[model samples]
Target: MRKALALSLCAVLLGGCASNPADRDISGTWINQVAIDAAAKGGPLREALQAYGPNLEWDVNTKAAQARYTNGFENVEGKLLGEKPGAWAVDFYGSSATELKRDGKQLSQAASENEPEQVFDRAVIPVPEGAPIGASFERALYSAYMGGSWQVVSGNGEGNTVQFQADGQVTGLPGADRYALCLAGDCASMSGGNDSIWLQQGGQGNSWIFARKGKTLEIFQSVNTALADEMPSYTAGDRKWLLEKQ
Candidate 1:
């Protein structure tokens, strides 16, 4: 019973943050900014976030919060337990509760005595549009196959590194911060049953597609998504793009 209670506590805590009062409503989209910035500089936390997937996001409403991950999302409806010394206490499962404190656009969650508090900020979330057919399965495969570090083999930025996260987050890729299994509604027919991935500058910036081999990734400049026939290939000169799993 104690183990089950502990698991329930973890589930509720990971679910998200919540609050009431219009002036202090902790509603909207929230992302772990600290984890993201730390992951970019490379360290133990980076590796951990990479393995855990960096696109962790939360959608908090007045009385509920939803935590989104690569595999999926979980929602936890909170009940107003009571008022704490400096925050609002919300109970998710019996005695397991989280305290929420909101200030402006930022929301802070009080942690246990040994754990550091977590902070989240209000932010806009980009919507992925034109999802291709079989995107779910393709996304799952992409997440499973691309979750690791890759070393650039022959690109202009040789010796650099890139990490493909299961949650669509990409790190150490020049001009790209996110990735997708398929976007622009053109990947299904273009892939020809082969594994492919897309790298985007920002969520809405220019994107390039790459075909994946066993342990190698190759990008063709001419096959960009801007044009219908655009597909990445092993081109010469500056367009020579390749990555090998490290």
Candidate 2:
């Protein structure tokens, strides 16, 4: 604790006031709060970072960060999560999806009238033989609502078709914002019928909640415990997917 304080103070005095990227961690959201905060308060580092004052979001599972720049349309935008202060500049556009694990034949969670749910056998979410899974599956739905050009950066995970535009943006995908990242470390399974996935985040001093259902997956979020966004973390929401093996 003392060492961290000293480092912060030394950097501030040096007139650079920056954290090293090599030592940065991703345990929370992508925003470099330490640096951005300094900038927002009109410190020496404000020019380069420009005070990240957008509706920020990200996926902890994939470590992808998104920043919604509102120059014109409020449809949402994407940007890579930065590692440190000085490196916190917009690279092209980027986003990410969340992930899962495996358990047995009991309802992973309960479904309520307010929250719809579905159940899969064993612990595998079945997608069409050629659909998508794992990281690839994550790609199809990641920060999709927070706009950006979507690209299938890797291979197939669970498998379902991901139709893309000539420019690589996804089309005819699930509901616009139907996705989630399990707040509890490495999640394994999701149950069905009014059953929703869980995500816990309260970065902006307000707890946000939302829900969506895909043709195969459904996601929603509801919680009271406020979460912080100091590292690579995610907000509260749900992501429901299928497990039909092709």
Q: Which candidate is the best by lDDT?
A: 1
lDDT of 2 by residue, 62-105 (tens): 25554332211133344544533322333334433111111222
Worst 10 residues of 1 by lDDT: 66-75
- The candidate scoring highest on TM-score is 1
| Candidate 1 global CA lDDT score | 0.53
Q: In candidate 1, what are the lDDT values of residues 1-246, reduced to their tens digit?
A: 999999999988876554335656665556555444443333232233334332344455555442221212233455655445546666666656667777667777667553356765554433346542223323333444576788988876788888886557878777778876542134434543333455677466543445555577776553433354656432112345788887
Write down the TM-score for model 1: 0.39
Residue pairs with backbone atoms closer than 3 Å in model 1 (clashes)? 220-232, 220-233, 223-230, 223-231
